[model samples]
Each structure stands twice: as C-alpha cells, then as structure tokens.
Target: MARAVVRAVSASPTAQAGGQVEEDPAHRTAAGLLASHPWHTTPLGVPGGWDPALRATIELIMGSPVAMSLAYGDAYTLIYNDAFATILGGKHPAAFGRPAADVFEEAWATPGVGDVVDRVYRTGEPFREAETAVALVRSPAGEPEQAVFTRGCSVVRDSQGRTIGVLTVATETTEATSRLQSLGELTGALAGAVTLDDVARVALRYGLSAFDVDHMTFGVDDASGWRVVRRVRGELLDEADERLPPLWRRLPLDSPSPLAKAAGSGTAAFTEDGTPLREVAADRHDQRQRAMAAIPLSTHSLRGALTFGRRHAHLWLPAERAQLTAAADLIGQAAERARRFETQHGTAQLLQRSMLPEHLPNLDRFRVAARYDPGIDGSAAGGDFYDAFVLPEGRLAIVLGDVAGHDMHAAALMGQVRAALRALALANPDPVVVLDGLDKLVGMLGTGTRSHELFVTVAYGLLDQRDGGLTIASAGHPAPLIRHASAEGQLATVGYLDVPTGTPLGLGGAHRAMTTALSPGDTILLFSDGVIERRRRELDDGLAALAKSVAEAVSGDPRNLCALATSAVAGATEDDVAVLAVEYASTPSRSATMNVPPEPTMPGRVRQWMKVQLSAWDVPEAVIGAAVLCTSELTTNALLHAGTAARVHIDLTPERLLVSVQDSGTRGTVTRAHTDTLSSRGRGLGLIEELSDAWGTDPTVRGSTVWFEILLSEDRENP
Candidate 1:
C-alpha cells in the first residue's frame, strides 16, 4: 500500500521546459522522480520509507483532481501529482523533489507563498491565499509571462501529534479572477503593486514590444456583470479619462456586441472596421479605427476576453495574433496574482493586529493614542508592538518595542515579550526591575536559536496617574520624545527623554531608568524606528527634521501628534512604524482605591465602600446610586472569573465619575477573564452595561480591566 502511493507519482511520458521538449533524464513524472531519484541525498532521505501518516496523506491527495503539493519533513521537500505540474512553469521537473525554498527561489522571497508556507510549517497554522501571483516563467522563449495560483495550506501532523509538514491544495484561478491587484509598477514599486489597468499600461507602454495597436481593452467578469476596460494608447485620451476605470458600463451576457459576444461564446473574432465595435465602445472606436480583435480567454473556467484596436489598416499576421493572446495571458496572470497577494497580505495584517492590545485603557488621567502602520511589503507581520495598561498602583505602563523581524516568528516573539513585560510589571511596578527581568528572559530565548538576528529593542515607561512624574527605561531603543506645554496650553519645547541606553535585549547588558516630571498639558511620545528612519536618509537629519516638524505643526492633541509622527516618512514602507502619545492633564480628580479578594462577600463590601466614598465626595445622589450598582457588578465579575485579588478604583470630577475594577492575577500565571467564562458572569457584565453611561472591558496582557463611567450631566447622573 505504501509503494502503491509511491507509484502514483511516477514519471509522465513527455516533459516540457521553457517551451522546449526535454529528453528522458528529466522527462519523468512525479512518481518517477520519487521512485528513481536518489532520496538519500535529500532531506526526505528514502522517500518511500516515510511514516504511515505521510504516506496516507499522499494517497489522499493523489486520487483527487485538484492541483496539490505536499511539503514533507522539516525542510519541506516537495511532492505533487500531475495536476500541479501544469502550473509549475519552469520550476517543475527540477522542482519535482527539491526543497520548497530551493525550488521557488524568487517566489520564496515574497509573502503569500514562502512566508506563509514557513509559518504554517513552524506554527501548524493553516493559510489560504486567493490569487497569489507566482512568477513561474518570467521569460518563456523571450515572452514574459506569469501564472496565478490560489492555494490553501494545512499542517500535516504525525500520529504522535507532532507537526511534520504542510499540505497545500491549489487552484489556478487566473482566468476567472476579476479584481486585479497592482503587481508593482513598471518603474518598480510605485504606490505599491499596480492595478489591472497598470498591466495594460505596461503592455501598451513598449507598444507590446512587437504587436502594434492604437488602443487595447481587457474585458473581465465579476458579480456585477461582464465589463470591458478600454485604454487608448499614448495620451490619445486626456489625463482625467485615462485615470478612470472603464466607462462605468456593464455589458449584458447575451448582448450582440463584439466584446460581449467574445466573452459569452468563448471565441476570438477580428473585424476589419469599426462598424461592429462601435455598438459598445463608440467613443474609442471612432470612424478612423482600422481594425479590432476580440480573443476569448480560458472561458471554460475563467470568463474573460481581450480586445485590441489598430489605428491604421494593417495585415493581421499569425504572430501578431499570438502576441495579443500572450498579452491577454499576461494580464490574466497579473489579475490572479494581484488578488492573491492582497488577500494574503491582508490576513497577515490581521494576524499582526490580533497580537496587539485590543483596547487601550480609558484612564481619565491620561490622554493616550497609538498608531501602527505596516511596512510596504506587508506579506508578513512586523515585530513592532505597543502596549498601554494600568499597573498595581495608579501607574500607567506604556511600552513600545521592535522585534528583529517581519514574519510570524517575530510577531509571536513580540507577543511573548509584551506578555512577559506586563506580567513582570504587574508583579513589580518598578520600571528598571521590569526591564531587567525582560532582558534576562530575552537572553534566555536566544539560547539554542537558529537565527542570529535575535535582537530586541524596547522602550518601557511608567507614568504615575496620581502625579505627572514618569520613569522611562530603554533596551537598545531610541529615546522617547517629550513635549512640554506652558500653563496657558501653548506650544512648548519638545525633546528626547534622557534615558540611559543599553544594548538591545538578548545581548547581555545592564538596564537603567531616568525619571522626569511632566508638567500639566505636556505629552510624551514613543515611536518605532520607522518614524525617523527614512530610506537613503541620515539618522541625525531625521531626528532634526522630526523635532522641527513637531515644533511647527504638532499641537497638544495626542492623536494629532501621533498621526503626524507616523506619517513623517509618508507612504514609505521601509519598516513597520508605530507611535504612542500620552498627555498629562492639568487639573486633578479625587480618587479612592480598595482591594477585593475572590471571596463571595467582596462584591457587597466593595459596593458599601464605593457608596461611602462617592457620598463623601459630594457626588450627586442619582450618580452615587448608579455608581454603587455598577461597582457591585464589576466587583462580582472579578470575584467570579479572576479567582484572585482585584483592585476597585473610583475617580470623581465635576464632569463625570469613572470607576475601574482590575484583577490582580495569580503571580506568574496568565489569566484572561473572558466575558463568557460563565452564565452568571456574563449576566453580571450585562447588568453593568445597562446601568453605566458607558462601559468597556480592556483586554490586558494578563487578566482584564472592566471600567464604567457615569456622566455628571443632569438627567444622566440620576440614572
């Protein structure tokens, strides 16, 4: 049975490479490559001797008709059936039994394919890309072409529950796809990837390098209907017209127009005059139009067609017709790849954001806002992460760090580092101690690691909510910038914090902290290297430019300030960028704090204390009642879910009353108090939501902070 699965991949009768027929040596099928090849020299080492799990998986995919590939073992050696060999372009035959990395050399560098494959293998997380543009044959016989593949991946685990490899099932959807993404511009990397219109623009740019046409149109189908996109060559149309997509017209499926007929019938047609083409594109196909050609694409699966028009009457040679088909093929490939690249890149951003803090604490004392912009090559998650949370006392912990990578591993490591920092900060609120512990943990994480680029730079600071005092520490990170303001809230001096620098975490170094007092209305800014570091620009110059930009344009608003800081390098995706701003208020608010254990009586006890405190502070009678009721629900939530000591804090001002309850986690344990832990706890949150003016649960690194606020406005305070 094992050998039966092995024989399924034996050699094909004929093999083709680069539009040339190949001889017997490399003319074997997948099965032949598996059977006759020297497996001992490769990573798989004795292919047919694989475990039952590997063999079973192979047998499962072999009987199927989809284009699928199997990457086995740690090295992810390749194995695919005949269906997949069609899309391999020039990579096949030679790619039959090679490591995925070695086979898809250029492809391995991009996202959606190589990064996703590596991530799936390492973390056992499956990934699916819609239209991953794979450059299979860049210049097949001097005719540059592309193949678009949409593939799904899943982990192949052994019986022992250990992940061994990744199984990929792919479908070539280039012809059927419509939403074409930009595949980098002809000038290379303009506005990121270029659009379907851009591909036509490229083809038309060099006059198709051979085929001459005054105008070109590529017709595609989507949910709306079949649509023909037209492009007039060489500034024949005004700039405004060229910038728009199509004429916003939908061609009916059964229409008699040439474009419609070609798409519907899946056939290619040519007209010597503009009479037939004038029905749909009368504006572009004027009387002077010499000829038009409509060629159906892979209509059997993907419904699309290509139309080209010539300005002068000319003979239509067979090679010229072939070039039109080739151009259409290139466009179809771009459309598929563009869609695939977008979906894959979007998912990577989602994964990166998922690891970040879901909600920043709405602390009344601090005005905070954070901004994160992914790099241009967003196929992988950038390791830059920022976190802001409430510590033991009223101290607000603000941390922003950059891990040394732009992949899943880096993003995962960033999450781990952030989690560890939060835990250490919760146990000990001292800035220096928290970083010292992180430095050690980061060093420990580096031991026995394959990557030599295991460096981490972090900026951690603690701001006392009770006062404006702040202590900041750094580990090979840039110094945080602080913007001061005068009593009148006017613009003031902005400069870097005097933090004592140390080596990036993982490399041995001692850490230190520097203390500074922020006057009321002042703000501190923390950012990743992406903000000040521009491509082909000096570091000192960037710093100087940022300072001047802040002084001239930035106001006291934290949101506005952070926005400008992140956009300093504007549209440049050289690296992952992040900026966090925290502002200190001028006025003080009265506050009271108490700790509640997991005991059943803690809720009632907390309510009584909250009531007495609110009444003593002269809070409105109606507001007092609502505050006490909401406090009880929050306290009950902690008592039921956290199972540890919790802190209840109440802050009162003339404007509104803010109450927060945070669970003090079990030392060294990560506890997430999800809202649906139990039916009663869920109802408890429900009750809080109903009574409080506005309530929210902050997702902390460890445990949770459930907060509610009651505005002191009339009619609202009483409720």
Candidate 2:
C-alpha cells in the first residue's frame, strides 16, 4: 500500500493552483451572482407558441439554482439563471433577447463551435455534449490553466415535432477525474495488443507516469477476466508482503473491479474509491489505491484494457486523458500496416512466377542453356527473347531480336515477332524469303506499293547435319561470331560478319541476301545488340570483343560456352542479351557455286533450258507445260533487254523449287499481259507470269536475278 502511494505520487505532477484546471473559487461564486438579476430577463418573442404565462413560469425556473439552461428565438434569447450567463463572461443584462453570436461573440466565432452550430441548424437535430477547454485569462506569476466544459444543445419542437427554436445546456466536469478514467480505459484495451505491443507499452507507461497513477497496467481479456500484460507502479505495490495482500491479480469478468467492467462491457469507466469492492479478492491493504479508471482497447481484433490505480484519489486530468486516447489510435494503425505488408508481398511473388518459362526444348548434339534477367530498376517485364526450332529441312533455324521498347506491350510484340519469324522460316528456308513473307503477313506492303519501312533486324539460318554446317543470313542484325577448335587445342575465328540483307523482314524492296557456311567443330553465336556492344563502343568494337571471348571459350568444350558467355556479359551488358550457338562435329566435303552462263538466243533457248532443268529437279510432267511457258517468258525478257548475255538457273529442295534468270542489264519490270497483246511480239514474259505461283527480282550490284518459286507437293514427288 505504501509502495503504491509512492508510485502514484512519483507519476503525478505536483498539485498546484496552476495545474491543467485552475480553480478560482472566490471569483467563481461572485461571477454567477452578478449575472442572475431579474433585469437580465427578456420576454418570449414568437407568436402563439410563446405564451406570457408559460414564459413567466420558464423565467422563474431558469432563475433557479439549476445546472442547465434554456432559450427561445427568431431573435435568440437567454432564458437562464446567473449560472448560464456566468458561462458568457462580461456580458451585459441587455445581452438577453440578442443574437447568440452577438452575446457570445468570442466563443461562437471559434471554428469548432461554428461547425457544430452549422450541423445543428441544418439537421435540426440535437448536438450533444461537445467538449472544449479554454484558459480565458493569463496568470500573473504562473502558466494559465484551462477550464473544461461539455455542452449539449438542440432545437425545441412544437406539438407537431417541428423545430421552433434552439435550447442549450452546459456541464462542467472534474478534469482530473475524467482524465484518470479515460487513461485507465485506454491502457486496459492496449494490454491485449499483438502487433502493437510496443505501442501499447508506451501508452501504459505514459498514463502511469504522467497522470499520477499509483499502479497501472494494460491487461489481456479472457473468460477469467483481465490478466496483467504490463504493469508499472511505485515501491509500495512492488513490495513482497505476503501477509499484507497481493496488489495485482486476475479477476473474473463478472467481478466488480474496473478492469472486469472494462473487459466485459467493452466500455470505459470512472469510479471513486468509496464504491463497494464486491467480488474483489484484494484485501484492504491491496485496495489502498483509492481511485480507479479502466478503458477497453476494442479497436482491434484483440481485446484488452488500460487499468489505472491511483493512491491519490483525483490524479488524472483532462489533458492527460486525451493523450491516452491518441496513444490507442497509434497502436491500431501499426497493426493494420503490418497486415497490409504481408498481403502485398505475397501477391507480388505470385505474379512473377506466372510470367516465367515452363519448359525449354532439347536439341541433338548441342547443350543449350537460356537465361532471362529483368532490369534492376522499377521496370516491369521486358521484350528480349531467344528461340530455336528445326526447319522442315534438316537445318536448324535460330533467332534473337528485341521489340521496339520495354513493358507489357513490348513483350507482346516480342511474342508476335518470334511466332511470325518461326512460321516464315519453316515456310521458306531462305532468310530473305522468310522475312519478305513476314512483310506480307503484317499487311503493310503489297505488290502495288513497295515502300513501307516497317522493319526489324534479324539473323536466321538452317543448320545442315548433311554438311555439318550452317547456311546463315542477316537482316540488319549483329553478325553471329563463329569460333572453331584449332589443331593446337586452341580456338580461332571461323567466319566474317554477314552484311545486312534483304531490308529486315518487314521492309519491301528488290534486295538480295547472302549465305555463309559453318564447318565441323565450329560454333555460330547469334545475339542481340545488348551483347558485345557497350554504349561507348561501336558495333564493330563490340563484335571484336565477342569474337575474342567465343574463340577462347570454345577451345576446350562447347557444352559450357553458353554459361561462360552469360556470366561474362551479365555484368558488362546493361540491357537484355540473348545468345544461341550451334556447333557440328564433322565438316562437309563439297562446294558448289551456282552461276548462270550468258544466254544468246531469244524465246526458243529459254524453252529448252526450262524443260531440261525442271526435269532434272523432277518437276512432274503434269506441270511440265506450265513450267516451260514460265521459263520461256522470263528468259525472253532477259534476252530482249540484255541482248548479249542472259541465262536461266533452277534449284530444288524439299522446301521450295526456285527459278532464277540472270541478265546483263539493269532493266525495268516485265508485264506479261502487254507482252501477250494481239499485235505484240513478246509473249514470253506474259506466259511466265501466268504459269508460276509467285515471282520477284533480286537487284544485285552487277545485275538483277529475276526469280520465282513454287511450294513442293506433299510427298515432294515428281509425279
């Protein structure tokens, strides 16, 4: 008991006149009397509702010694005793029957009261006890202190319940008593805090130390009532006096202690020491704390209480009690923040997993490893990718390219580019033909208008197991670096960078593509600009660096070359880089250069050659007549224009049957319909146009290769 007393004293500020609420007892009583004279009365002003007799009765009652006040209006009047007028200090007797704002100008002008008055007037509903504190005058020697009040006001209604005028009442509470009650309840609720235990502790300590409480604790609620979760007190309560009594104990929810009331009712309480201590297990020694307050922490999932035990009966003040309420709010916010963090983190992880690749293809004679690295900044998913697949021909086609930008839209475009590239490659193995087909697929270019600049740089090739080599072509993309194992167990460069070919797949023009062959024990590395090139370095410099790296890595084993290159560029490359390499074990043994010897004869010469080559390539006799006519027209056009040297060449593979006519001069386009005119002598080009499926020209530095192609039959048969 002594220890609890000491604790309470230690927590509380020294009692003085200038505490949170200052008492001016001598002036307080006089102020009330001076404002209560009959001269302060004013007559009721509304029509039949304001009866003279009733007004007199009301005035008599108002003048009595009651704590409440009343009023009526159009012209707002004061129908109250001196107690009411004393609340409006320095007001004259004539202030009655005046507007509320005029009489209590200083108070009504405050922002808080203005908002309250607006609600009352607009809703026509009572505005109950609005709390406020004010220090009207400064002290001569010490800090001025607040005088606290709780006000309730409403409209008075007629028989029909229609609002006729306003009525008001004000109540003054013991500031210390109210604050102690509020603090106890706040801490009681905070005791059961889970995520906010730290916040709860801070509130409890502040309540006990700053509010002069003898013993204070936050406690968790259970069926048994409140269990002390945290407690702070002075030496008395801390003592080990078995005979005296235990100061702290868990009480049943139904017990008449403040903690039990707070937990069961989920409400706050203020009680005096004199209240009967029914069902309390504490003895007189333990019950020495004369004042008590408990506030429930019902703001979160857990239930708890802030319980206060004070040695000095009236330790809590209004300002300290408000502080406890604020502390409880902080604890609730912390708990909510923790919950949100966990939920969001889980969602982010799920989204990332859904976007990653599910499986990678297995290739023969080669070990392949692919890596996708996202940008480190706040960028989302990107558009860089590498893909490889087998063509109908035995050769493997590989590709790597970037969409125009980064983001979901760019990733989507990357997919479109990849799918289109694969389809075109399979349809026609020639890299230039595949890209030209893509332009047609995208709906940009047509035979009539051939100037659309829509383009993407790509490098594609067919890996030939028959020759142990790759026939590769490029469309404005970086050349693949070729590395081969030398006889000395060292690596060396194998091929030069293929020049930009056939104006990237999308652009339409009369352009030619070049092919390079790879031999046995060689690796061809295809990559995007992200690899090899740094911002400060030109493409040639970047390519040189890549060649050096590949030559060294390919020396020992081809299987780990991919992993090695990935690590090398991972730090050096800032953007997405994709690398795909194909190496063969044995080299092919033959080389053939296809060249068309100059043709001299006109229409007849074309007819004979087309028949021989088409038969050699096993073109069916069923289409032999059509093939002969197509060759006749193309060769005739070449003969008429060049007139010196023109020839025809034919090649057949499982994918396509291609025909090319070499001529000496750079000539204009051939329109077969005009050539087939009634009086026209040139029926050759017209016959070729009607017979072939599709045809175009490859404009070369020396001359153009006028060519066309036909898709092979299902069995690739001559029949």
- Model 1 — which ten-residue stretch has the worst lDDT? 182-191
Tell me the number of clashing residue pairs for each predicted model. Answer: 15, 25
Candidates in order have lDDT scores of 0.66, 0.49
Q: If scored against the real structure, what TM-score would every candidate get? A: 0.48, 0.33
Candidate 1 on 1-719: residue-level lDDT in tens?
22353553333122111123334753466555555555556666554345434554554444334566778777888888777877776566778768888877766777677888789889876565667776654333434355677666777775335577777767677432211111111111111123444444444453323344776666666554665555565644444334322232356677666667787787788887545555554554444466878877552235777667777666666756664564454445444434455457667877888888877877777877787777744556889999999876778999999997788889889989999999999899787888889888887787756555798999999898877889889999998888876433345688988899887888778888889888877889898998898767788877776666566542454555676676555335468888888978655568789988666666778878987888788888888887887788777656544557889987765556778898853221112222123123334555666776565554343456777776577675445
Q: In candidate 2, what are the lDDT values of residues 1-719, reduced to their tens digit?
A: 11222223223332111123233442233232222222223344222224222332232223333233444545455444455656555453435445665655545656556456556655766565446775432222434345577655555443223344444545466444334333323322222222233344445556666566666765555445554433436533312121111122345566666666676677877655643233462444345666677777654445666766766556455665555544444333333322333244334322332332333344444323344443322134455667767667556666666544445654555666777777777677786677666656543532334534334566766666566555666666776766765654345655555645555545554334556565556666676677766666676676666666666652422324444455544235556555666655442211112333333334565566667666765677746566566666666555444333565665443334556676765222222222232112234444555556555553322344566555455533455
Cand. 1 Cα-lDDT = 0.66
